[model samples]
Target: MIGILGFVAVFAGGRWLGWAARWVWLLAWGWLLVLLLAHAPYMPPELGAFVGGEFRGWFVLGVLAALALAYRTGLRRLQGRVAPVVAEARPGAFSAVELDRYARHILLREIGGPGQKRLKAAKVLVVGAGGLGSPALLYLAASGVGVIGVIDGDAVEGSNLQRQIIHTDARIGMPKVFSADVAMKALNPFIEVRPYHRQLEEGFAAELVAEYDLVLDGTDNFDTRYLVNRVCAAAGKPLISAAITQWEGQISLYDPTHGGPCFECVFPVRPAPGMVPTCAEAGVAAPLPGVIGAMMAMEAVKHLTGAGQGLRGRLMIHDALYAETRVIGVKRRAGCAACGGG
Candidate 1:
């Protein structure tokens, strides 16, 4: 009994002192080994008596402990493999868990309970899952936006891991939309995530944009950007668009329906091919997207909850190389192709 108690005490003390589990196990095993040696034929009888346990009994205890540890490890692995199901909150009300989770936002003067409730009721669509979209989507989900739709046709690549922080190396081959969906759900399961693993087509662009309250464009190419802008303009949905290149990025809220310049109004003519290089050709800084993407999410939150001023009618340019930021006012163009000075 004394030997068993001593072994337990040593193991518990080591663990309580924040020792590594392997070290604690080693200490316990060393204690048992000492007891076994004390019981050896060559040891003094008084030592064996003092150790207070038969060798076989101590060995059985060690086997039981190993089995228990193995069982716990396997159980934990199984639990990790299982997907957790979070309960859905009733419409127009927050559950206890949600209330606690958003207590900080609720306590804020701007985004109080009513603002948070608006966030919970809002729906947003993200046009890409790359650098800018990664942080934008993550923050939107973390902010408890009710429903988020992400659309992308590309697969996660090793090259994207640097700027696209939402994707992991293990998900390199996964579709960007699905990867973003997984990350968003993992961050906050209370929100609904709709992943479209296909390019946004002109056929469904208008229909899709109409489904969400707002749109965020983070695509790299010009064709898709123009298509998204056109569809968003036709649907009268506000678009928060951002673009990042080597050491620089820009974001704006384009909503001609709300007295703001649409994307085409600000830049009517598409840059000549090869004149403006993509990130693949230009090589952007790693943290630049996070900065701009987080700002995009912040603007979206502000737009949805009416917490503060939004980026409507203004373009924010961030020059990471020089650590400078500038906001320039934009206006609706009279003969804009997408949104004609409405």
Candidate 2:
């Protein structure tokens, strides 16, 4: 019992004091050899002869095992010292676990380690945890964006289960922001999720837009969409806004600060009353939001990482029923209202 306790203490201390790691196995094996040599004298005549003959073999085996342990322990300690130096040399260095998690992204020449680092350093605010917000938030979190803020005043309902994929049926009646927060955090434990369980009002929209590097407007209503657009434009932050209704969806990045058209450049005036119907009133296809929202997430990734050409001055329109996709060039309307004349 004393020997066992002594062995445990030595092993723990050796591992803790890394400089003593290589000698631990040597000491342990030497102690075992001593015990065997001491006990050999008291054994029976036959046993004594057998022990004398086997001593050389046992000694050789112990030495070999001790050498192997020494090599392994020394290498581990060396690696432990070198890892921090390597991490310090590279900006935004990732841990072994993080590198493995984002291995696929790192492999992409377009979005390699530098791009992944940018994704990790980005801050994106997504307005409305509804249809378009669902997939956008999910993919953003999965992509490793460092911080994601989700704002919504509504709660999950039985009717929302059709298009809002982030909210599970069990989460019905829960605040949409909280549901989204749970989903995003579950998808990527590395990212931060901020849930604003309130509506996006003009009084706070400007301040909120200024806080984020980018804004994604997935709100279902025209009022909030225009509000987000104006605030993002005023703050010079890029905005990725997408809308889905019935069978079609539209998405674009509005950044007049960088010469891209703002949201109001294309739609200077809201449609005449009753000209356009809400998704709730007109009914959207289940997959329409999924398609548009995923695209919105993709655009956000591109914008943050500078990986590929973004939808800067172009609008992407997808018609699910017709199986058609089109891109239209939109220019900033100079001398007009909203983002113009600034």
Model 2, span 1-342: residue lDDT tens: 344454676788788888465498677766566545734656566653443435555567567877987898899999987744221112366778678878999999999999999998888999999999999999998898888999999999999999899999999999999999888877777788889999999988888878899999998788998899888888889999998889999999999999888999889989887888899899999999999999999999899888889999999999999999999998888775788734
Clashing residue pairs found in predicted model 1: none
TM-score of decoy 1: 0.77
Where does model 2 exceed 4 Å of error? 1-91
10 residues in a row with least lDDT, candidate 2: 83-92
For model 2, which pairs clash? Answer: none
Worst 10-residue lDDT window, candidate 1? 84-93
Q: What does candidate 1 score in Cα RMSD to the true structure? A: 6.6
lDDT of every model, 2 decimals: 0.92, 0.85
Question: TM-score of each candidate?
Answer: 0.77, 0.73
- Overlapping backbone residue pairs in candidate 1 total 0
TM-score of 2: 0.73
